[model samples]
Target: MRVALLTEGGYPYLTGEARLWCDRLVRGLEQHEFDVYALSRSERQEARGRVGLPPNVTGVRTAPLWTTDDRTLHGAGPRGGRGRGARRRFLACLAELAEVVCRGTGPGPDSSDPDDMADRFRNALHGLAELARAEGGLVGALRSEAAVRTLERACRAPGAPAAVRAARVPDLLAAAGLMERALRPLSLDWYGDGALGSADLCHATAGGPAALPGLLAQHFAGVPLLVTEYGVRLRAHYLAAGEAGLGAPARALLASFHGRLAAEVYREAALITPGNTHVRRWQERCGAERAKLRTVHPGMAADRFAEIGERGYDGRADASGTLLWVGRVEPAKDLVSLLHAFAEVRAAEPGARLRIVGTAAEGREAEEYLTRCRALAARLFPGPDPADGAHDDGAVSFEEIGGPGVPDLADAYAAGAVVVLSSVVEGFPISLVEAMFCGRATVSTDVGAVVEVIGGTGLVVPPRDPGALAEACVALLRDPARRERLGAAARARALELFTVEQNVAAFRGIYLEIVSHCPVRRDALDEAGEPVPFAHPAEAHVPGRWAASASTAEAAATPSWAGRETDGRDRLKGAAV
Candidate 1:
C-alpha cells in the first residue's frame, strides 16, 4: 500500500513531537511505501534538520506553517482581471463561515440533517480550495483589504455575537492574518491527483493543519482519510488563545474557526484514532462519529529499559524507601504539590526520601516555577538527615536529569523503589509509561489519560491534592509485595499495549482491511495496455462506469465510518470562505 503520512510541527524533523515514532512506523512497515507531507512549526525546528530517512519512505515534501515563505507568499496578485470575481466569491463564503462561527449550531459530526452547519462549512471551504487551485494561489487575496472588509461585514451582520461585533481595525487585521495562515493549505499546490490523491490511503498523524491535505485529496480523488491524534489540537488552540497577543475578537474567531474545522474533518474522515480515551472523548464532543473512532496507544520501544525492568523484580534488587519523580520541570507537572505531598510522607515515615529528577522546561514560566518548587522543598525538608553520616542523601533532593550523576533515563527510574507523576495537565504520561516500562510501581496524578494508561497498574490520586497524593505514596511504600505485583503487571501491560510491535501490527492489519474494503474508482493498465486485475483501492465493491445527475453526483464519493458503513455525500456548492 502507498500511504501519504501527513504531519504538523513534527516528524521528519530530527527533534519534535512523534519524530522517532514516525521513523519507527515507516521502518517497521517495510511492506508499504510512504510519502511524508510535513508542516514545520518554526525556523529552529527546521534548522535542526530532517532525520535519516528509512528505505520504505519514497519521498518527502514540507511547507512552513509558522514563518511565511518569501518567494511564494509574496508573489504578484492574480493576473487577467480574476480579482473581482474571486473577491465576490470569497465574501459570500466568509459570510456563511462567520455566521456559523459566531453563532454555533448542530450536534457535531453525528448530525443527520442534509443541509447542516457542516455542509455549509464544507461548501465554503471547498469554494476557497477551488479558487486557490484555479488561480496561481490565494496568498495575495487572503491578505488583501477586500478580505478584511469582508470579515468586517460578517462580524457586523445581524445575529452576530456582541464579541464579534466589537472588532476594531487592529482586531480585523489580526483576524485576517490568522485566517490567511489557517487557510494556507488552500493556497498550497498539493491538491491535485499526483500529490496527496495518488496515495492508497491518506494517514494524518494529527488533526487541524496536517489533515488539510488529506481533506483536499478526499475531495478531489475520493481517497480515504485516517486521522490519528495523540494530542488534541482543538484543546491546544483553546489553551494558546488565552496566552495573549491577539485581540478578543480575533481569538474568538480563531477558536470558532478551529472548532468548526475540527468538526468538518471529523465528519469527512474514514477513521479517527485517538491515542487514549481522554482524547477520544474530546473528539466525540467536537462532533466525531462514534463508529469512526478507534483508540490506538502511542508506540514505544521497550528494549531501552528491558534489562533494568527484568532485574528490578521481587522487591529484592536495589530496593530503597526512595521515591522518584522524573520528567521536564513544568507548571503542568505540579511539582509544588508533590513537594507538599513529600512533606506529608516524611511526617508519616521520617526515613522516606523524595528525589525530583528532571531538567527545567525551556522558558521563563518553567524557570520561575522551578525556583518556587526548590524554595518550597527547602522549607518542607529543612536540611540533610543526621542519620546519613557520610553521603548526605537529603530527605528532599531536586536534581536535573540527563547528566553524569543520573547518566541515563533508566538510571533515574532505577534510583528509586517507586516512580511518581504529579502533573495537573497531561496528555499520555510518557514519564509514567517509562516508569512502568522500567518495572517500577507508580503513583501518578489522575489527569488526562494517566488513569487510562495506568490500567490499575499504579496508584492514582486527584491532582493538586497533597493529602491524597501523600497517602497513596505512603501506602505503596509500606507494602513491598503490592508494589512488586503492580510493577510486574505494569511491565506486562506496557509490553502488550505500548510496544512498537503491537502498534505496527495493528496498523498493518488496518491498512490491509481498508484496502480490501474500499471500491476502485479508477482502473490501472499493464505495460501491454491491458487492464490489470485488482490493481488499486483493493478488490471488493468496484464502481461501475455510470453517469450521475448534477444533484446526486457526489453520493458516490462520500466517506464511510472506517470505510465500514455508508454515509451520504456532502456536496460542495456556494461561495468559498
Candidate 2:
C-alpha cells in the first residue's frame, strides 16, 4: 500500500517529539511505500537536518510554521489584487468562522445548537481552505486589518460569550495572529494528483495541524484518513494556554478554535488510534466515536536491555540500597518532590541513596529548574568529606546517562534496586517502561497512564506527597523477594505488550483491514482515454488462480448448492447414503 504519513515538528527531523517512533514504524514496515509530509516548527529544527530515511520513503515535502513572509505566501489571491470577488469570499469565510468561535461550542444560552454550530464550523473551515487554494495563500488576508475587524465585530455581537465580548484591540490581534499560523496548512499545495491525492491512505501521526492536511486530502480527494494521537493536541493547547499568560479573550478564542478543529478531525477520520486509554478518553470526550477508537501502545526496542533483564536482580550489595530516576529534567517531572521524598527515604534507611540520571529539557526554564533541584538536594543531604581520599559520593548524586557512573541507559537502571518516577504530570511514563525492560521494581506516583502502565506490577503512591513516595521506596528497598517478584512480572509484561515487533505487527494488520474495508476507487485509462479492463480486480489482492481459471471463475459465480433446494429430506438422504 502507498501511505502518506503526516506529521508536525517530527519524523524525518533528527530532533522532535515522535521522531524515534515514526522512524521505527517506517523502517519496520518497509514493504509499503511512504511519502512524508512534514510541517517544521522552526528554522533551527530544519537546520539540524533529518535522520537517514529508509529506501521505502519515496519523497519528503516540508513547510515552515515559525515564520511567514512574501516568499512563503507567494502573493496569490488577495495579495495580488484578485478583484472584489476574491476579497468578498475571504471576508465571508473569516466572518463565518469567527461567528461560530465567539458563540462558544457547548450548549449554553448564548451558543447556537450543537449540531448547527458543528456544521457552521466545518463549512467555514472548508471555505477558507478553498479560498487558500484559489488564491496563493491566506497569510496576507488573515493578517489584514479587515480580519481583525471581523473578529472584533463577532466578539461584540449580541449573543457572544462573556470572555469573547470583552476582547479589546490587542486581544483580537493576538487571536488573529494565532489563527493565521494554525490555518497555514490550508494553503499547502499537497492535495494534487502526485501528492496526497495519489496515496491509498493518509495516516496523521498527530492531531492539530498535522491532521489538517489529511482532512483536506479527504475533502478534495477521496483519501481515507487514519489519525493517531499519542498526546491529544487539544489537551496540550489547554495546558499551554494557561501557561502562556494570554488575556482571557485570546485564550477563549484559541481554545474554541482548537476544540472545534479536533472534533472535526475525529468526525472525519476512518479510525482513531490513541497511544493509550488516557488519550482514548480525551478523544472520546472531544467527539470521537467510541466505535472508531483503538488503543495502540507505543513501542520500544527491548534488545538494548535484553541482557540485563535476563540477568535479573543479582542482589548486588552496592546497588541494593539505591533508587534511580531517569528522564528529561523538566518542571513537570517534579524532581523537587523526588528530592524531598529521597530525604525521607534516607531517614528511614541510613544507607539508602538516590541517583538522578538525565539531562535537562531544551529550555532556559528547564535549566533553571534543574539548578533549583540541585540546590534543594544539596541542602537536604550534604556531601561526604573529601579528606579521607573519597570521591564526591554524596547521599544524592546527579549524573547524565552517558556520564562515568552510568554510561548507558540499561546500566543506569541496573545500578538501582528500585526505579522512581515522581512526576506530578506524565503522559505514558516511558521511563517506567524502560525500568520494566531492565527488570527493576518501580515506585511511581498516580498520574497520567502510570496506573494503567504499571498494572500493579510496582508500588503506587499519591503524587506530591513525599510521605507516601518515601514509604513506598523504603518498603521496596527493604524487601528483596517482593522486589524480585515484581521486577520479573514487569519484565514479562513489557516483553509481551510493548515490544517493537508487536507494534509493527498491529499496524501491519490495521493497514490491510482499513484498505480492505474502504478500498481506493481509481479508474485506469489508456492513452486514448479509453477505460482499461481488469486494472484492479478482487482476485489481484487474493492468492492463487481464482481469476485465471475459467472453471474456477464459473464456480465462484455462485454457490455450489445454490440451485439445489435443501430440506430435512435432503439431509436424511445424505445421512443414509
Candidate 3:
C-alpha cells in the first residue's frame, strides 16, 4: 500500500525529538511505499538536513513553519479585504470556533456541551476545508492583521472574562502568529488526486500540527488515517503553554484550538496508537473512542544489553556496589533527592558509591542541576576517596556519554551493580529498560509508565521519597541472588516486548488489520471496462493510467516528489499550492 506519513519537526529531520523511531518504522515497513509530508520547526533544523531515506520512501515534501513564505495574496488590498464568498466562509469558521472556545472556557454544561462542541468543531473544519478549496490556500487570510483584529475583538467583546479583556495589542499579535503557524497544515496542497488521495492509508507519526495534514488527507482524499503518538502532543502543548508565560486567556483560547483539533483527528482516525497507557488516558480524555485505541510501546534494540546481562553478571562491581543513574542530567531527574538517598544508603552500607552518567540535552537546566548535584556530593562525601576511613566523602562520580571521560554507554551500566532512577517525572524510562537489557537489577521511582513497563521485574519506589528510593536500592544491593533473578527476568521482558523487532512486527500487523477492516475505495475503471477498486501500491502503477505515469516518473526523476517539477508527475506531487 502507498502510505502518507505525516510529521512535524521529526522523522526526516537529522535532529529532532522522535526522529529515530519514525525512521525505524518507515524502514521496517518496507512492504508499503511511503510519502513523507514534513513540517520543520526551525531554520537550524532544516539547515541540518534529513536522515538517510530508505528505498520504501517514494517521496518527501517539507514546509517551514519557523519562517513564513513570502507569497502574498493577490485579491486582498493593502487593508486585506476579501470577496463575499470568502468572507462568508471565513466568518462561519471563525464564529463556530469562537462558540466552541466559549463553551469550553469553564462555563458550559458537561453532559450536552461536548456534543455541541463537536458540532462546532465539524463546522469549523468543513468551513476551513471549503475556504482552502475556494482560495487555493488560507495562508494569506490567516496571516492577515485583519484576522488578528477579528480575534482580538471576539476575545474582548461582551461576556469576555476580565483576563481576556486585559489583553494588549502585542498579546493579540503573538496569538495571531501562533494561529497562523497552527493553521499551516490547511495551506498544504497534499490532499488531491495522485498525492495522499492515491495512498492506501495516511499514517501520522505524531499528533498536533503533524496530524493536521493527515486529517486533511482523510478529508479531501478519502484516505484512512492512523495516528501514533509516543508523547501526547496535547499534553506537551499544555505543559509548554504553562511554562511559556502565555496569559490565561490566550492560553485558554489556544488550548481550545488544540482541543478541537485533537477531537477532530480522533474522530476521523481509523485507529489511535499511543506508546504508553499514560498517553492512552490522555487520548481517551480527549474524546477518542475506546474501540479505536491501541497501546504500542516504543521498541529499543536490546541485543547488546542482553548479552552483557546474560554473560557479565559476575563481572559487576564488588565493594559497596555503586548505584548508577543514567539519563539527561536535569532537575526533573531529582538528583538532589538521589544524593540525599545515597547519604542514607552510606550509613547502612559504607562501601556504596553513586555514579551519574549522561549529558543534558536542553538548555541550562541540565548543567545547573549537575552543578547543584556536585555541590551536594561534596558536602556528603567530603574527602578524596570518600569511601576511605578518613571521612564519609559520599562517593559521587559524574560522567557524560560520548565524552572523553566516558566513551561508551554500555560500559556505564556494567560499571555498577544496581541501576537507580530517581526521576520525579518520567515518560518511558529508557535507562531502566537499558538496565533490564544489560541484565542489571533496577530500582526506579514510580512515575509515568514506570510500573507498567517494569511489570514487577524491577523494584519500584515512590517518587520524591528518599527513604523509599534508598530502601529499594539497599534491598537490591544486599541480596545478590535476588538481584540476579530480577535482572534475568527484566532482561527477558525487555527482549520480548521492547526490542525493535517486536515494535516493527506489531505495527506491520496493525497496518494490515486497519487496511483490511476499512478497505480503500476509488472511482476508476478496470480491464473489463467496469468500475473497479484501487487496492495496492502495485495496482496504482498499471499502464495507460495516471498511476502508471507516477511509477514511471518516480523511476526516471530524482526518485522523489520532494521538489518542484513541471512534468505530468508534478500534477500529483504533494506541496502547498
Candidate 4:
C-alpha cells in the first residue's frame, strides 16, 4: 500500500513533536510506500535540515507555515480577476466562516443548538477549501483588507460571543492573519493527482494543521484519512493562547475555529488514534465517535535501556537514596513542587538526594523557569550555592542528560533509585515510560496519561501537592523490596505495550484494515489510455505468492484468465477458497 503521511513541524525534521515516532513508524513499515507531506513551523526548522529518510519514503513535499512568500501565495488578486463573481464567492464563504467562529458554541449547552452550529461550521470550512482550490490560492485574498473587514462585520453582528464582540480593529487584523496561516494548507498543490490523490491512505500524524492536507485529500479525492493525536492539538491551542498575548477576541475566535476544525476532522476520519485513554476522552468530548476511536500508545526504543534493565536491582550503594527527575525543564513540569517535595523527603530521610537531569525547553520562559528552580533548590537544600556550580554533589543537583556525569539517558536512570515526574500538565509522560524501560521505580503526579501509563506499577500523587509527592517518594525509598517489585512490573509493562516493534505492528495492521475496507477506486490504464486487465488482482490481497507469477511481461499485460469466459471472476473465487 502507498500511504501519504501528513505532518506539521515534525517528521523528517531534525526537531519537532512526534518526529522520532514518525521516523520509527515509516522505517518499520518497509512494506508500504510513504510520501510525506510536511508543513514546517519555521524557517529555522527548515534550515536545520531533515533527518535521513529511509528508502521506503518515496517522496517528500514541504510548505512553510511561518511566512507567506510571494511565490508561495501565487497571484495577487482573488482568482487573478476572474471578475466580481469570484470575489463575491470568496466574501460569502469568509462571512460564513467568520460568523460560525464568532458565535459557535462548541460541544456544550452554551450554544442553543450545537449540532446545527457544527454543521454550519463544517459547511463554511469546506466552502472556503473548495474556493481556495478553484482560485489557485487564498493567501492573496485572506491577507487583503476585505477579509479583515468581513471578520469585523461578523464580530459586530448580533448574538456574537462576548469575547468575539469585544474585538477591536487591531484584534481583527491579528485574527485574520492567524486564519490565513492556519488555512495555508488549503492553498497547497498536494491535492493533485500525483500527490495525495494517488495514495491508498492518508495518515495524519496529528490533528489541527497537520490533518488539514489529509482532510483536503479526502475532500478532493475519495482518499481515506487516519488521524493520530498524541497531544490533543485543540487542548494545546487553549493552553498556549494565554501565553500568546493575544486580545480576548482574537483568542476566543481562534479557539472557536480550532474546536470546529477538530470536530470536522474527527467527523471525517475513518479512524482516530489517540496515544492514551486520557487523549481519547478529549477526542470523544470534542465530537469523535467512540466506534472510530482507537488507543495507540507512542512507541519508544527499548534496546537503548536494555543494558540497564538486564542488570536488575543491584542496589547501588551511592545511588540508593537518589531521586531523579528527567524531562524538559519548563514551568509545566513544576520543578518548584518537586523541590518542595524533596525538602520533605530530606527531612524524613536525611541521606536522600535529588538529581534533576534534562535540558530546559526552548525560549526565554523555560530559561527563566530553570533559573528559578535552581534558586529554589539552593534555598531548600542550604548547601553550596547552585549559582557557583549547580552540578556539584549537593542534596539537590541539576545536570543535563548528555553531560559528563550522565553519559546518556540510561546512565541518568541508572544514577537514581526512584524516577520522579512532577508535571502539573503533561502528555503521554514519555520520561515515565523511559524509566520503566530502564526498570526504575517511578513516583509521578496524577496528570495526563501518567496514571494510564503507570497502570498501578508506580506510585501516583495529586499534582501540586508537595506533601503527597514527598510521602510517595519516602514510601518507595524506605521500602527497597516494594521499589524492586514495581520496577520489575513497570519494565514488563513497557516491554509488552510501549516498544517500537509493538507500535509498528499495530499501524501495519491498521493500514491493511483501512485499505481493505475503503480501497481507492481509480482504474489502472496503459500508455494508450486503455484500461489494464487485472491491474489489481484479487490474489494480491491473499497472504501468499499466488499473484507472483503475473510479474512477467506477457502475464502482466494479459492476465491468465483473459481467455476464459468468466474472466477474473473465476480466479477471484478460486483465490477466496
- Every candidate's lDDT: 0.76, 0.80, 0.74, 0.81
Better of 3 and 4 by TM-score: 4
> In candidate 2, where is summed lDDT lowest over 10 consecutive residues?
568-577
Best by lDDT: 4
lDDT per residue for candidate 1 within 1-577, as digits (tens), equals: 7899988889989767878778888999998999898877777898988888988888887777665444634442343367676556656666666666665522233233534767777777776666566655565676777777778887888766777788899988877777677677776666555567678889998888889888877776667789989898889887886775787888887887898899888988888889999999999988898998989898998998998888865343335688888888988899889988988998998878887778646779888887788777767766763222211367777666665547687877877888999999999888888888999999998999999999989999999999999999999888888888999999999988998898888788877766666655456777899998756543445443322221243443332211211122122111111
lDDT of 2 by residue, 60-88 (tens): 88887777666644442365366576677
Rank order (by TM-score, best first): 4, 2, 1, 3
Clashing pairs in 4: none
lDDT of 3: 0.74
Instruction: Name the regions of candidate 3 deviating beyond 4 angstroms.
Output: 69-79, 82-84, 107-112, 157-166, 318-320, 384-394, 523-577
Off by over 4 Å in 1: 72-82, 105-115, 245-247, 314-319, 384-392, 525-534, 542-577
CA lDDT for candidate 2: 0.80
TM-score per candidate, chains pooled? 0.88, 0.89, 0.85, 0.90
Name the candidate, 3 or 4, with the larger lDDT value.
4
lDDT of 4 by residue, 1-40 (tens): 7899998889879989899999999999998899998888
- Summing lDDT over every window of 10 consecutive residues in candidate 1, give the lowest-scoring window: 568-577
**What are the runs in model 4 whose C-alpha is more than 4 Å off?**
72-82, 105-113, 317-319, 387-392, 525-577
* Candidate RMSDs in order: 6.2, 12.5, 7.5, 9.4
